[model samples]
Target: MSTQSVPVLAANDAASYLDLGITLALNNWPALTLAVQSNWGGPTSDDKRAWLCGAISEMLTERPETDAEDLEDVLIQVMNDEFDVVIDDESAAIVAVEIMEMKQHTDRGNFTEIQAMWEAYQLKSQQKSASAAMFKKVDAKDEDQETDDESDEEGEDVEMGDAPALVRAPREKAEPEIDDDGFTMVKKKR
Candidate 1:
């Protein structure tokens, strides 16, 4: 006997899209913010548009049945009804395409793959942040080496170390690295 293949989303899934999208947005806020900041190399307006679109796209993908048009529809609804921000269909469509590209990177029903991808993304982002901090420390050391003759005298004025220009809020826990084969390895405390 042969069986017909059905789409992954059911009627319940359709009903859950909005709520699920909201949950996904809230839960992934940090990652989403990083994505928006890192991906934008454009003007403020364009970057906001792209960021909103990408967020909507990411939200819809969680429901399994949404597509590019649905992405635009959600964005339009949010902008007009929810936020009172006006946007035309053409602009929405452009934003939708940008986000849909992210979804198309993964196959359907392979959520583990998507999770691993995110783990890798988060891991690399943290690494970049660490290296940037290291470079800043080195730069600070370099700046300290310009000695002055008068400053060396006992009666001369002495200045304490300057406060860092870039302040980093401490992270609670480090993200585990995902292996090349898509497995996240956590370090267990012994």
Candidate 2:
């Protein structure tokens, strides 16, 4: 993604960038152990300097505004640059100022925004599922009542009346029960 001329990465993908801190020291930063240890590159003192220079150059091309005073500065800027691309510091150090493999990345601003949107999407999705579940339960209850009504049709012969039947149920009469230990029990009917 592109934002303000800097490429943006999805927030989820960009979390790795934060994990790989720009200041973390690579093998060559301390000494040229590769050439001397494994009989590979980083053999000479100059070779060590070359590796540092190459890393610096990689940082420069990726971020043009990355003006640095020395090797340390380059590392800092590249690690923090918004372009998200850089020299693969995770790779072996060559003791010469040469180009390294470029690793691309997203800027921080875009990543934060994308992360927020992802959270909102998840919340809305949850709410919709809950509402759907509630409606399903109501519909299931209605279907059950309809099945009971169909079975009762065979038992009764309902004679048509002059007036339409009231849809409302007859209200039960309110009565108070006397339990004072001095009254006889009685029942009433209407």
Candidate 3:
């Protein structure tokens, strides 16, 4: 797993980030906003701040499980540079700041591209399995018909053309030959 840090938005600076996060969420730009909120707490300003660093971290993370340290690192960087707002404001402000950073990192490509790739893989896998199963059933049915035909033949040498279903010829066994020099030649049996 890649090491990711949870951003520590100077506890005083978290409020602003939280607001940005909330705005995006309220404005219907919820993909990134909601995702960030998953890491954020649900109720109250204080609880929301605790989840503040996580919301930004999730935006930067490539997968669902991100490194805490990585999240913290990004949070610190965003707060130190792009956002200078104090973190200790009411929880709403902190939520706003998180929303801002989330907006910055959210990419249309990440959502659409990954979704298409996953769907294509699923479709191909399903088609392959369905094809294999169809072939198997056809093979089994053919085998059953051959067995029935063989039983009806009564040990007779059934003509190949007369057989309704195709039956592969059994391999002929080779016999060993005795050489004039008194050496025995081993023949491969099929």
**TM-score leader:** 1
Which candidate number has the best lDDT? 1
Score each candidate by Cα lDDT.
Answer: 0.51, 0.42, 0.45
Candidate 1, residue 32: the lDDT equals 30
Tens-digit per-residue lDDT, 43-79, candidate 3? 3433343354455535544453434445545444443
A best-first ranking of the candidates according to their TM-score comes to 1, 2, 3
Q: Model 2: which ten-residue window has the lowest total lDDT?
A: 95-104
Ranking by lDDT: 1, 3, 2
Q: What CA root-mean-square deviation does each model show from the true structure?
A: 26.0, 24.0, 19.0
Instruction: List TM-scores for all candidates, in order.
Output: 0.34, 0.29, 0.28
Q: After superposing candidate 1, which stretches have Cα over 4 Å from the reference? A: 1-66, 73-108, 147-190
Better of 2 and 3 by TM-score: 2
Candidate that beats the other on lDDT, 2 or 3, i.e. the better one = 3
